[model samples]
Target chain A: MDQLYTPSTEKCELVSASKGTVKFLLDYSKSLSIVKAEGMVFENNLN
Target chain B: MEHQTDDSTLVQDYISGDERALEILINRHNQRITSFIYSKVLDRDAAEDIFQDTFIKVIKTLKKGNYSEEGKFLPWVMRIAHNLIIDYFRKNKRMPKFEGGDDFNIFSVIGDEKPNVEKQLIKDQIDSDLSMLIDELPDDQRDVLIMRIYKDMSFKEISECTGVSINTALGRMRYALINLRKIIQKNNIVLTNY
Candidate 1:
């Protein structure tokens, strides 16, 4: 147990550390929206 | 296995007129960063809006040749997300509420008696940084830690949920903390109060 678990002395300040996985999938349409938005940014930057 | 390009190299490539580099970077980090923002906002449209705004800022910064964050691209982008989340809350005049009982409130731990945006934002930035570090943990350990800390579950509850014994649950929690410390040190992440 000692070798497996070394207790951390660092203070825990996280309010809540939930799971990192997104609940909703990014899906194709939403991703395309982002791509479209990026295209607009590139176009504007060029203009 | 195929070789995956590191974020800094991709960022440099994007800066040097390689459009594909930016696409790869965005696609690589899109899920995690979007999940982070969505977790905070809890509104799909708002989260997506902020995500777009974040990349827009990233593009502007890179285009102006002011992108000096070196290899720390994800954290820098997360900071931008953090600021945008704060802005979203300020504009809406509210904060994201934890969905559990009175066991813990994130705002309580991070906020003052009176609402202080600056302190809250700073603490939120630290929390966001910590969240990124937490992502580095093994899935099993991360599941145990999230159940124990975020869900406020007991060892017995965690064991029951994960179909393991209470002792195993406790062991995983312990290992989670130990590994979290190692990851923090390895990444040079500062989790202290500013």
Candidate 2:
């Protein structure tokens, strides 16, 4: 059983790491998005 | 116009008290964002509106304690923009096409510019070459690179968007970049020429 799943284990780790990274970006982008949106609004109002 | 602050620094400053950090980030990326959205919508006005909405979505998420500073930031916003465009299409039941891989097609919207004849000639050569190269790429490789570089999507989001596996997406990009390099070398054009 151990031999059968060893490669799968490594791949799972890779997938998990990638998933973690994606989650972080999603969260960070969510925070930064507001200012961007608001800035555009202010610019549009002036034009 | 330029990236006044690095993205990481901008985020940190925003977390503290600098009101302009967000503005800096927006200015740094707005042109890229605009072009990506324009690629999808093929309508300059609607692209501008979607561009605003994508940034707005980013801002609102940041304030609500939902932001996590992980992985590639540009790709995340790109995914949002892509989704919004897809949603827009769903509502209208229409899809846009790029005719004959014309890279300069987008530039027409930003016209009435002064003449810099020498520079324009160089730019025109590069644009035509790039368009030709892209048209010649294998469809899988071409599609992924367009989304990755042009639309600014990450492999994972692209997988979600296209229903392809992540490995497949990355593999396509790897081949695409290699093929593009070969094309550039064969044509004796610098990669930056595009």
Candidate 3:
């Protein structure tokens, strides 16, 4: 009896929450990539 | 040229003190790993901090010759990221309660308060965050979440399709909801109709 279940719009919001989080991560990773690339270029110039 | 390289090769190179290889590996898995952490914490600055911490741990573990899981480098690093997310929760003294030491059920704790027009933008932002986080869930849990939330499948049907017990499917859904609520609270997500 304790395990009865029901669905709500909140559940849908949960899915949306995860989707937005991943999108942010992808966007942030791009900035990190640019920084890494610049560092690599500098290192190559030094060598 | 680096695009054709596989993870194990990069891991071995890193173990041999080739920092460039580690950089390539990070570049390869950074988005997925970052997304996974952001899904749990839902804070950009916090996610970035944990992201850096995760890679620091990866470097230390590899340098110490303790990375035993060969050919599974990304998953290993992700495990580290997940653990750090859990550590963040524990450290903040806001860790979600788990049932039977497995499933985290926080639906009851999530307030049913409705947001007004003034908080519409904030609610929209939170909704977007939730969307991305769901994509980063572990395969099994994500599958259950998608089936239950998006596909609107019953736990019995989920078990039939995934070949797990009904209880396992139910547990996954519970954990999914709990994790979502935790991220929502941690990030100050404001729910509203828009």
**Going through the candidates in order, what is chain B's TM-score?**
0.47, 0.45, 0.47
Q: Model 1: per-residue lDDT, tens digit, B1-194?
A: 11288888888887776767776677677777777887787666677778877877787677656789555999999999999999999977765444567687776657768637887787889889878777888999999999888889999989999999998988989999999999888878788765
Which CAPRI category fits model 2?
A: incorrect
Minimal lDDT window, size 10, model 1 chain A: A21-30
Q: List the global CA lDDT of all models.
A: 0.72, 0.68, 0.69
Root-mean-square deviation of each candidate, in angstroms?
A: 25.6, 24.2, 24.5
- Give the per-residue lDDT of model 3 (tens digit) for B65-178: 667865488788788888999899898777554344346446545755766566776777767877887876677888999998889998899999999999999888888878
Local error of candidate 3 at B180, Å? Answer: 46
How would you encode candidate 3's per-residue C-alpha lDDT over A1-47 as one tens digit per residue? 64576443332222112344444433333323111353342111111
Per-residue CA lDDT of model 2 for B1-194, tens digit only, reads 34645677777676565656766667667767777777666666677677767876776555544568785668878888899998888876655443456465666645668647877887887777787898889988998988998899989998988789999999989999899888888878774533
Ten-residue stretch with the least lDDT total in model 2 chain B? B95-104
State the weakest 10-residue window (summed lDDT) of model 3 chain B: B96-105
lDDT of 2: 0.68
